[model samples]
Target chain A: MKRFTAICLFLLSVVALATPAFALRISIVPDHGNPASPQMGDRLRFHTAIQNDGNAAQEGVLAWISLVETDSGKEQPVDLEDWSAHKAVVSAALLPGQTVESIWPMRLIKAGSYRVVVSAMSRSGETLTASPFVDFTVRQKPVVESSRIVPVALSAPLLIAGLLIWRLRENRARA
Target chain B: MNAVAVIARKEAGDLLRSPRGLSWLLAMAAALSAFSLLLISDAELSLLDNAEAVYGMCAVIMGLGALLAIVMGVDTVAGEKERGSLVPLLIAPVARDRILFGKLAGIAMVWAAMYLLALPYLWAAGGAGQNLAEGLVSLALLGTPVVLGFGFLAMGMGARLGSTRSALMVCLVILLLAASPVILGPSLRQTAVGRIFDWINPLSVALNALDAVIIDSQAVVSQWLHWNLTLLFSGITLWFARDGFYRTAL
Candidate 1:
C-alpha cells in the first residue's frame, strides 16, 4: 500500500505538469486617418498585432475588435462579416514569435469619447488572452452650411405666396 | 406480446400525431441545415488549411445532435403524464419496468431517425473529400448516453411531480450541467478550481472524443469513458424513476 501511494503521488504530479502554460502579447497602433475628429459614417482604421511569446505554438486563435463608449459603457464590434465594407481586417492564427496584423474600421455614429478593445483566445484547452484598449475622440461637425441655407430657402416660398395674395387683393379693390 | 415493440409502436404513433413533436423535428432540421451550410461555406474557402477546421465543423453537427436529444428526452415522460393517459397505462397488464424501457426505446428510436436524416446533409456540407466515418461513429457513441441521461431525468421528474413544466425545468438544469464544461473549460484551465470542473464535465469528454475522431483519427476510449459515466448516471436515475412511479398515488 505504501508503494502504491508513492506511485500515485508521482503519477498525479506528472499529470499536473503535462498541461502547458501560454503567454501572449497584444498591442494596437492607430493607422489610416487621424484618431482625433472621427466623424459619423467615416472609416476609422487601426492596426493590431498579436504574438505568441511562449515557447510553444498555440492553435485555434480567435480574435475580434470592439469599440467601447467611455461615458455610457456601450460597446460596438467592428463588423468582420463585412470586413472590407467596414475596412476591418483579421488573421485567425499567429505563430510563436510571429506577429499578424489586424485592421479595424469603425463608424462613429454618436459623438462621444470612445476606446477600442482587441481580444484574442486559444480554444478551451488553454487560457491566453490579450485585451488592449485604445482611446480616441469624435468631434461634432459644424452645422454652418445647413444653418445658412435654411432661412433663405424657408423665406423664398413665403415671399412668393405673399406677393401673389397682395396682387389679388389690389386687383379686387380696383374692381 | 413483445413488450418493447408494442410500446415503441404506440409511442411512436403518438409522437407522429402530436403537433409539438413534428414542430420539434422541423425546428431541429432547419437549425442543423443552416449551421451545416455555414460550415460548408467555410470549408470551401480553405480546403487544405488545417485538420482542426474540419473537426470544428463536425463538432457543430454533434452539438446540434446533443441539443435535439435533450429536447426529446425532456418531453418523453412528463408530457405523457400531463396528458392524463399515464395512470391508465401504469394500471395495464404490462410490467412497469417494460413500460419504462419501452418509453426510453421509443424516444431513442426517434432520436436515431433524426440523426440518420441529418447525417447525409452533414456529409454533403463537410465536402466530398473529408473522412467523416470516424466522426459519425464517435457522435453515435457520445449521443447515446446524452439521450438516455436526459430521458431518465425527465421520466424521474414525471413520475414524481407529474408535471411537464417541472420536468422541462429539471431537464434544462441537466442540459446546463452537461454543457457547462465546454463553455467554462478555457477560464478553468488556469486555476485549480477550473481544473476540477473540467475533469468532471462530460461535455469535455464528448468533445475530446470528437477531437480524436475528426482531428486525430484516434480510438474512442476517452469518449467511451464519458458515455459510460452518462450510462451510470442514467441507471441511477432510472432506478429513482422506477421507485417513484411504483410509490406514486396513481
Candidate 2:
C-alpha cells in the first residue's frame, strides 16, 4: 500500500508539470488582392488568427492593432487616423483546440510603407504579438492637366509687366 | 564673491531691460500655460485615461523651458559681443570663470522665476488630484539638470561663435537634440540607428526621467544616473566655454 501511494504521488507531480497553465499563438495573414500600399485614401484588409494551445479554455483575449513604419531599421508608429483606418478591440474566449479569426479593415491615407502589428492579451496576462510589414509606393496626382498651359498662365502677366516697364524706361530716356 | 554677485545683478538688469528677454519669458509662460490647459482638459475627458496626458504636458513644458534657456544664453555672450558691450566687460578685473558663472546664474534665475509663475496654472490643471506633490518635487529636482545643461550649451556656443545668428543656429541644433525623442521615438524602437540615437541623445534621457517621475513616482536615486550624465556634459561644456572665452579677443 505504501509503495503504491508513493508511485501515485510521483506520477501526479509529473502530470502537473506536463500540463500547461496557459498558451497562445498569434499570426497575421496579408491579402495580396488588397495589398497594403503607401497611397493616400487607399483601403486594404488583413486577417488575424488567435489560437489556444493549452489544454484548457482561455478567457479575456483583448486585441489591438497598429501600423508601424520601418525605416532605417527603425519602427515608427503611423497614425491610424492619418491612414484612414480604424483600430478595433475584440474579446473572446478560446477553448482548447479552437481558434478565432479577426478581419481588420485598414485604409491608407498618408503615403508610406508600414508594418501592421497585432497584439493579443489573455486575462491571465499571457500576451502574443505578430507583425507583417508591407512595402509599396504611391504616385502623386497633378492638380491640373496639361503642362503647356502652365507657362502661358505664368508668363502672360510677367510679359505684360515687362513690356510696360520697358516702354516707361524708353519714354523717360527720350524725354 | 561680490564680483560674481555684481555680474549677476548686471546680467539680470540687462535681461529685464531687453525687449527680447521679456518676450522670451512671456513665450515660455505662454507655452507652459497652453500645455497645462491641454493636460487638464484632456484629463477631464475620461477618468480611465492613464498618466499619458500628464507626461505629454510635462514634456512640452520642459522642452519649451529648455528652448527659452537657450534663447537667453545665446544673447548672454554672443549678442553682447555683437553689440560691442562685451569688450568693456572683458577688460575688467573679473575672472572669466566668474563671468560665465554669473551668466549661468542669471539665466537659471529667470527660468526658475518663469517656472514658478507657471506652477499655479499647472496645479490648477491636471496636476491637482494626481501626485501633485511628487510631481512638483520631481519638477524641481530634475528640472535643474536639464536647464543647466541647455544653459551651458547655449553659453558655450554663444561665446565660441560670437554672433547671435550663429548662436541661434546652435540653439536650434540643441532644440533638435532635445526634441529628437518625440520625433524619433516610434521609429527607434525597431531600428539599430534609432537605438544608437536613443542612447546618445540628452533629450531622450530627459524625457525618460520625466516619465519615470510622473508615471511611476520613481525616487531620485532611480534618476541619479541620468542626472550625473547631464551634469558631466554641462561641466565639460562650461569648461569649453571658459577656454573659448580666454582664447577669443572679446
Candidate 3:
C-alpha cells in the first residue's frame, strides 16, 4: 500500500510539470508611447508578442486583435475592417522559448472609449490565451468639416449653369 | 482625317448648343455637388474612410457619364433620321463608319469635360488622402473604356433598329443587368454565377480596379488584366457600332 501511494504521488507530480510545456502565451504593447487619449482620425499601432511557453514546438498558431467600444451605453465589439485591414497573423511553427512579434496598424475612425486585446490559439491545442485589454479614449475634433466643402459643392453647378446659359444665348444670336 | 475632324467638330457644337444636352451637363454638375455635400455633411457618411468617399464619387461619375453616353448614342442615328438630316449627312464625303467615329469622338469630348468638372468634387471628398491621385488615374484608365463602350453599344443598337425608343430600352436593360451584381448581397456575389459574371463584366472590372488601386493601394501594373478586358470590351462594341452603321440602308 505504501509503495502504491508513492508511485501515485510521483505520477501526479510528473503530469503537473508537463502541462505548461505545451502552452503558448501572448502579450500586447502600444507601438508608440501609449496615447491614453488619441484624436479621431489618428493612426494607432500596436505590437503583439507571441511566445511559445511550451517545451515542444508549437505549430499553426494564429493571433488576432479585437477592439471593443467600452464607453457607449452598450458595450459592443467594433468592426476592424476599416480600422485595420490586416488584423490577423499566422505562425506556421514556433519552437520552445521562441517569440514572434507582429505590428498591427489601425486608423481611428470613431470617437469613443475603447479597449484593444490580442488573442492567440494553437490549432493543435484546446487552450486559448489573450492579453489584457489596453484602454484608450478617442477625442472628436470640434472643427466643422462641412464649411469647407459647401462652397465648392454649391458653386461648381452654378458656374456650369452660367456657361450653359451663355452658350444658349450665343446659339440664338447665330440663328 | 479632315472629314472626321470636321464632322466631329460639328457634332460637338450641335450638342453644346442644344438645350437638352446642356441641361444634362448642368444636371451632372448639380448631382455631383449634392452627392459631395451629402457625403461630407451626413453624420454617418462623414465618418467613412476617405477612400470609400472617393470610390462613391468614381461610381457616380461613371454612372453619370454612361447615362449621358447612352442618351447621345441612341440619338446619334435615330435623331438624325427623325429630323430628315440623315440623308444629307450620309451623302457627305465621309463613310458611315467614319461618321460613327466622329460622333463617338464628339461624345468623348463631353465626357472629358464632365471628368474635368468632377475633379474639385473628387478632391473635396478625398481630402488630402493619398488615394486621390490613384483614384483619379484609375477613373481615367478604366472609366473611359467602360463609359464609351456603353455609348458604342447603344449606337450600334440605334443603327440596327433605327428607333431611338427601342435602342434606349435595350441599353437600359443591359445597364440594369450589368449593374445588378453590384447591388446583390455579399453571399450572392460569392455564388459561382456571380463570380463568373463579375470577372467578365466591364463595370465590375473597373470598380474592382478602383477598389484595388485606392483601397488596397495596389500597383496599377497589377490591374493590367482588368485594363485589357475593358479595352477589349470597348474594341468589340466599337466594331459592332461600325459594322451596324456601315451595313445600314440609306
Candidate 4:
C-alpha cells in the first residue's frame, strides 16, 4: 500500500507539470514593426507577429489592423469621408510554440498624425488574444508644402515694390 | 496716343484719391503680410521645392485678382453715372473708344500694382532663380487676361445698366456663377455639369491653367483655347460698352 501511494503521488505530480505545457496560449510579440514616420503618398506597411506560446496549436487565427486619424481642433474622429483601407488577415494554423508574421499595406493619401491598432484574434468568434497601439506620422506632400510657403515669399517684396511704384507714379502725376 | 494716355493718366491720378482703391491696396497688403509672417515662422516651408510653393501661391492671389476685378470695374462707368460724374468724363473732347481704353489703362495700373505687390511674396515663397521667375511670369501673364475679361465685363454691364446698384447685383450674380467650381468639392466638381461649367468659367480656366503649368508642369500652349474664349469675351464686352454708353441717357 505504501509503495502504491508513493507511485500515485508521483503520477499526479507528473501530470500537473505536463498539463500546463500542453495548454493553449496565444500572444502578440512586439519584435519588428513599422517605421516611425512615413512620407506622403507612400504605401505604408505595418508588420505584426502572432506567437503561440503554449504547447498546443491554434488553427484559423485572425489579425485586424486599423488607422485612426486625429486632426487639429477636433475631439471626435473625422469622418473617413474617403479613406477605406482597413482590413483583416486570417491564418490557416498556428502550430505549438510558433509565430506567424504579416505585412499590412496601406496607401497614405492625406497627411496627418495617426494611430495604428493591431489586434490578434481567433477566427471562430472574433475573440481577441492581444491588442497593441502604434503611433504614426505622415509628412505633408511636396505640392502641399510648396503651396503654403511660395506665395508669401513672392508676395512680400511685391507688396513693397507696388507701394514704391504707386508713390513714384503719383509723384510724376504731381510734377 | 495722346488722348488715351492723357485720359488714362487722369484716371490713374483720380484713383490715387479714391478711397476704394486705397482701401483695396491696404487689404491686399495686409493679407500678403499675414501670409509672409506665417511662412517666416515655420521651418517646414524651407523644406519644400520652389516650384511647388509658387504654384500654390499663384492660385490664391489669382482668386483675389478676380475679386479685385469685380470691385474695381463694377464702378468704372455705372457707379460714376449713378453718382452723377460721367458727364464730365464723357463731355471731354476725346473719342468714346479712346475714353474707354483710357479707363481700361487706369484699371491696368491697379492690376500692375496688385501684381507688383505679389512679386515680393512670390520671391519669398519660391526662393531665388528660374523657379521664382517661372511662377512670376506665369502669374503676371495670366493676370492680364483675368483683369481684361472681368474688367471689360463689369464696365460693359455697368454702362448698359447705367446704375451702380443694378450693375453690382448683376456682376455679383455672374461672379458667383463663375466661382461655382471652386466653391464645390472635387468629387462634385468632377460631375458632367460641373465639368461643363468649369470649362466655361474664365476664372476657372485660368486657375486650371495655372495649376497645370505651375503644379503639373504642363505646356502653356495647351491653355490657348481658354485664352481664346477669354479674349473673345473681352472684345465682345468692349463693343457692348461703346454701343451701350452712347445709347444710355447720360
Candidate 5:
C-alpha cells in the first residue's frame, strides 16, 4: 500500500513538471479565411486573435504582422510602411483565459506569392509564439490600365496644338 | 453694354487667340500628358496611392495655371504700355477701374480654360480608387482664388513698374518665394517660422487643403480656415491692383 501511494505521488509530480509555466496561443486568418485571389493595389485585411492560457495575467506582450515574399527563388521581406501605417499592437494586460483580437489592413503594392504571419513576444521576453503562415498569391494587375491612359495622354496635346494652329491661321487670314 | 463688359470681351479674345498665350497652354498640355503617362506605366510610380497621384496632378495644374496668370497679368497694362497702346486705352470711354476689371476678367477666362483642360488628367490618375471628385472640388475652391490673387498682384506690379520685363522678374521672384514650401522637408515645415509662412502663403494653403481632403479624407467643411487665407490674399491683391491703376501715368 505504501508503494502504491508512492507511485500515485510520482505520477502527479511528472504531470505537473511537464506542463508549461505560461501558454500564449495565437492564430491568424485573412478577412474571409480564403486567401485565394489577391491583386496589386488591392487592400487586404487580416484578423488575428491572441489568447492567454496561463494562470497569471499577461502584460506588455507585443504582437505584429510580418510579410515575406515567397516567389520561387526570390524570397525577401516586404516593407510595410506603404502597406500599412499601424503595424504593431501592444496589450497593457491580458488576464488568463482572455482572448484579444486585432485587425490589420494592408495595401498590396507588388505582385508575387507571399506568406504572412503574426508573432507575439511575452512580457518577460522569455517565450515567443507565432501563428501559422497564411500563404497567398498577388497577381499583377492587367495591362489594360496603361492602354486606357495612352489615348488620353496622346490626344490631349494633339488637340490643343491643332486648335492653336487653326486659330493662328484664322487670325492671319483676318489680318 | 457696360464699359467693363466691352473691354473684357475684347481683351479675352485678344489674349486667348494670341500666339504666345496659346503657346503657354500647349506647353501645359504637353507637360501634363508626360506626367500622366509616367504615373500610369512606371512600375514604382504606379504603386503610389491613387489619391496621392491626384494630389500631385492638382499641384502641377495649380503651378501651371499660376505661371500663365503671371505672364498675362504682367502683359495687361505693361505690355500695352510697351507697345505704345496704353494712351489710347486710357483715353477711351472706359474708366480706369473698368479697365482693371476688364483685364481681370480676361485673365479669369484663360484660367478657367486651363482648369477645364486639367480635368481629364485628374480623372485618369484618380478616378479608379477614391477622392477624385472631392479633390477636384477642393482644387477649384482653393485654386481659383489663389491663382487670381497671383494674377492681380502681378498686374499691380506691372502697373507700377510700367515694364513687362521688370514686372515679370519681380513676379517670378515672388513665385519662387511662394513655392519654397515645396522645397522644404516635412519636418522643417513644422517649425514655428515655417508654420507662419505656410499659413500666409496661398499656394501652401491650397496644397495643404488638397492633402487633407484627398489623402486624409477630411471633409471640405473642415477647411474653412484655408479658404479664408486664400480669399484674404486675393482681396489684398485686388486692392493693391486698384490703387496701382489709379496711380499709373498714361
Candidate 6:
C-alpha cells in the first residue's frame, strides 16, 4: 500500500513538473527604420527581437520573412527569393522570459508597395502552439528621380540653337 | 458662327490635314512616350517607377510649345504676307483686332492638342508622386499663360516684320533671350540678375510651380506670386500683339 501511494505521488509530481508545449508564450518586437522607401533591386536589412515569456525554453527557432498580401492583409507562404535569411536559429538557452535578437536581410526584386512579415517559429513542427510576428511596409524607390532631366535640360537649348543657326545660314545663302 | 470660331476651325482643319501637322503629331507622340526613355535605362518599367524621367518629357513639351508659337506665328502674319494671303483676309468684314484674336485662338487649339498628347506621359512619369494631379493642373494654370506670353510676343514681331525670314530670326532671338536664364549656370542663378530673372521669367515660373506641386507637394498659395507675374506678362504681350496686328493689318 505504501508503494502504491509512493507511485501515485511520483506520477502526480512528474505530471505537474512537465509543462505543456502550448504554454510557451513567444512574441516579437516590430522594428522598421530608415530607408522605409527602398529602391527596387536594393538590398535591405530588417532587425527584430523575439522573446519567450512562458515557462518553457523555446528551441530550434527559425525567423522567417514573408510577404503580406497587399489587399487581403494575410501572410503569404515563406519564399526564398523574397527574403534574406532562411536558416533555423537556435536560441542560447532562452529560458522562460528570455529574449533573442534576429535579423533578415533581403533584396528588393520588384517595384511596388510591399508589406513584409517576420515570424519566429519552433523547428519541431508540432511543439509550438503560438508564434510571434513583426510586420512593416516599404514603398517603391526612385520616386523622385532627377538624373534623366540633366541631358534634356542641356540638350533642348542646343538643339533649338542649332536649328535656328542652320536656318539663319540658309536664309543668308539664299540672299 | 462667330468670326473667331470660324477662323479657328479653318486654321485647325488646315493643320490637321497637312503633312507638317501629321509630323508634329508623330513627334509629340514619340516625345511623350515613356517606353523609349525606359528602354534607355533598362530598369524594370512601371508607370511611376522613375518619376524624374517624366520631367525630361515635360521639358520637351515646353520647348516644343515655344517653338510652335514661334514657327506657327510665322504663318500668323509674316508668312501670310510672304505668300500674299493677307490681303484677301484683310478685306473680310472682320475687325482687324478680331483677326488677331483668331490667330490667338488658333494657337490655343494647337496648345490644347499638345497638352492632350502629353497627358498620358504625365500619368506614366509621375503618377506615384505627391500632388501629381496638381502638377498636371499647373499645365492649365501656368503653362497656358506662359505659352500665351510667347505666342503674343512672336505674333507682335511677326506683324511688324511682315517677312518670314526676319520674323524667324527675331523669334530665335526671343527664344535665346527667354532660355538664357535656364542656360545660366547654377552659380549665375544666385546673382541679382538671375534672382530677378528667376522671379519673372515665365518658363522658370512654370517649371518652379510644377516642381513645387509634384516634387515638394506645397500649397498653391506659395506659387501665387510667380503665377501672377506670368499672367500679367501674358496679358501685356497679348495687348501689344493686338496693337501691332491692327496697325499691320491694313
lDDT of each: 0.60, 0.64, 0.82, 0.66, 0.84, 0.65
Q: Report the Cα lDDT for candidate 4.
A: 0.66
lDDT of 1 at A12: 84
> In candidate 4, what are the lDDT values of residues B41-87, reduced to their tens digit?
54444334456567656766776666676666767788778788788
Pairs of residues clashing in candidate 2: A40-A109, A73-B191, A75-B187
Estimated TM-score for each candidate: 0.55, 0.56, 0.68, 0.64, 0.69, 0.58
Per-residue lDDT of B1-250 in model 1, one digit per residue for the tens? 6897789767665544444455555555556555444433442222322244445545554555556555555555666666777778878889877887787777677767666755655454433434467667777777566555556666677667767777677767866776666555557557896666555655566676677766676766645666776567667766776676666534
| Model 5 spans with C-alpha error above 4 angstroms | A1-109, A115-145, A172-175
Clashes in model 1: which pairs?
A: none
True contacts recovered per prediction? 0.00, 0.00, 0.42, 0.15, 0.45, 0.11
lDDT of 6 by residue, B111-203 (tens): 887787666556655554545576667667878888867878888888887877888898778777777755664575788988788777778
Residue range A1-175, candidate 4, lDDT tens digits: 9999999999997775455333333333332544456665555666677776655466777776656776666424434323435577777877767878776666665678877666665543334564466666788744324454455555554654576567768768988
Better of 3 and 4 by TM-score: 3
After superposition on all CA atoms, how large is the RMSD of candidate 3?
11.6
TM-score of the B chain in model 5?
0.95
lDDT of 6 by residue, A1-175 (tens): 9999999999986765464444334444433553555665565665666666556676666555566435355435435544454434555455667677766676555544456655556643355443444444544455434344334433433443454556557757878
Ten-residue region with minimum lDDT total, candidate 1 chain A: A141-150
Best by lDDT: 5
Q: What ranges in model 6 sit over 4 Å off?
A: A1-175, B34-51, B181-187
lDDT by residue (tens digit), candidate 2, A15-123:
7545544466777876767743334444677787877777767777777787777656655787676443447656668788788888888655444456677777777
Per-residue error (Å), model 6, residue A75: 24
Worst 10 residues of 3 chain B by lDDT: B180-189
- Runs of candidate 4 with Cα error greater than 4 angstroms are A1-175, B16-19, B34-52, B128-131
Give the range where candidate 3 chain A is weakest over 10 consecutive residues by summed lDDT.
A140-149
List, in order, the clash count of every candidate structure: 0, 3, 1, 21, 0, 0
Q: Can you write out model 3's per-residue Cα lDDT over A12-69, one digit (the tens) per residue?
A: 8788656653478888888766466777767789888889977777888889999999
Interface RMSD of 1: 27.5
Whose DockQ is greatest here? 5
How does model 5 score by TM-score? 0.69
Compare the candidates by TM-score and give the number of the best one.
5
